[model samples]
Target: MGRTRTFDVNEALEAALGVFWRKGYEGASYADLVVATGVERPALYSAFGNKETLFLRALERYASNYANYVPAAIERSTARDVAEGVLFGAVELSTRFSDRTGCLGVNGALAGSDEAEQARAALIAWRADGEAALRRRFERARSEGDLPANSDCATLAAYVLAVAHGIAVQAKAGFAVDTLMAVARQALEGWPRSGNTLVAEQRL
Candidate 1:
């Protein structure tokens, strides 16, 4: 085998992820990553390539490590449960870490500079994938009679994600878990069910 790698790559990546979570893509400097990872820029570069590549790797790690809620929410038997699962999960996640208050997906690139458009696009696509997953789940829910036949699954998905993203923003701004849970509940108030509203919309 080649010479043994000295630093723990997992720990380095985890540290880099924490820096990205707290500071964001454009906001996080090499110095921040260096301090966070306890690895010099040269070693970091040799291990992970450029900053963007490191951030992308961190994104993959975040998805694998933290975004388990997406699938858990999707697997719920009812559409309402799916929405509630994600919304409440977002609330929990956004407030779980005191140091890194919000979501990586929301915080990592939402505040990027114009020069960081590639990173911004990556986060945009990240959220879009979530919306697509929710939309597919909602379509299944509609077929299973958990949602109105005329319910706009795409809109529902977008609405839920919008609220979830909003929760992240608010959490970063120091909102409490109870406050975010209230927001989640308020969002669920508009969840479309399979009967009267459907008939009313049909009649309209």
Candidate 2:
């Protein structure tokens, strides 16, 4: 009879996700994954094929878990609430992680090379799709009388997404959570009010 394998695939993948999340694709070595996942090199090669394959899988897992949090927040709240939640949550997420790794997709885009260009493109596309989705939600909110007709859904969506990316970069640059939060609040408060007014509101 063949001997039973002791390691769990899902658990191993989760561990690998952490290493990749912290060090990124190009930065994470095979030894790093081996150490993080507690799996033998042969087992990793057999299970995940190669380092690129394993990193892609880890990216998928990271996107599946963390990327969805923003959309989920959108689904659970009003348009304004969605915007605020996503921005604030992103800031919190960047800082809350023990390793303080920045956004996985952002890091992937920065570190991935031509060999992994497709993966980087996919991450960029995903972020764009997220912004578009937010624009649609904002449009719906406008139609539902939740926002003023003059509200520019596309621009607001872009602004919010830009804020998110800025937060991610700042987090990666070692900015404190409080600083990011302050930036988020400032962005939120600066959002154009109804009737095309450009004046900023008082802090919430």
Candidate 3:
């Protein structure tokens, strides 16, 4: 009979995520994963297939945790509140990490090679879908008269996402949290305002 494995898969994945998060996809070696996850090579391969597969799994786990912020903010706050919260929250999270790893997806986009192109594509698609959902939320806000009829949801969503990406990059570059917050504030200066009507947008 095969020896029983004793490691927690979720915990191992989380550890792997931290390694990948700090060092990025290409930078993270199998040795790093082994050290971080406390799993032997054979156990790691048996659980996660290979390095690329393990990295993809870590990416998925990271995305699952990070992608919910915007939707949750939108769901729990007013349109303006949601906009501010999501942008600032991103900056906060990015700066909180020790290496200031920015965003896993954004880092992956820049760091990935042809071998990891599929992972990069999936990350980009996920980001695009997130932006689309935010756009829809803005459209709903406009339709309900919580924003100006002339407000362009698509452009606004793109602008917000751009700001987020910029913040992520800047954070990775060792930018101060105050500077990122200033950037967020500047981005929000363009938000549409309406009379005192608010609704909690649904979570994604």
Measure candidate 3: CA RMSD: 4.2
TM-score of 1: 0.92
Residue 1, candidate 2: how far off, in angstroms? Answer: 7.3
Off by over 4 Å in 2: 1-3, 195-204
Model 1 poorest ten-residue lDDT run = 195-204
TM-score of every candidate relative to the true structure: 0.92, 0.85, 0.88
lDDT of 1 by residue, 38-150 (tens): 99888999999999999999999989899889888899867888999999999988998999999999998766578788888998898899999999999988887778888
In Å, residue 27's CA in model 3 sits off its true spot by 1.9
> What's the true lDDT of residue 99 in model 3?
57
Q: In model 1, how large is the Cα lDDT of residue 124?
A: 89
Runs with alpha carbons beyond 4 Å of true place in candidate 1: 1-3, 196-204
Per-residue lDDT of 85 in model 1: 97
Point out the higher-scoring one by lDDT: 1 or 3. 1
Ranking by lDDT: 1, 3, 2
Model 2 agreement with the true structure over 1-204: per-residue lDDT tens digits: 855677998899999888877777778889998998899999998888898888778877877787777878779546767888889988977877868457877776575568777667777787888888899999987876667888899998998988988898899899988999999999888654453222222322
lDDT (0 to 1) per candidate: 0.90, 0.80, 0.81
Off by over 4 Å in 3: 195-204
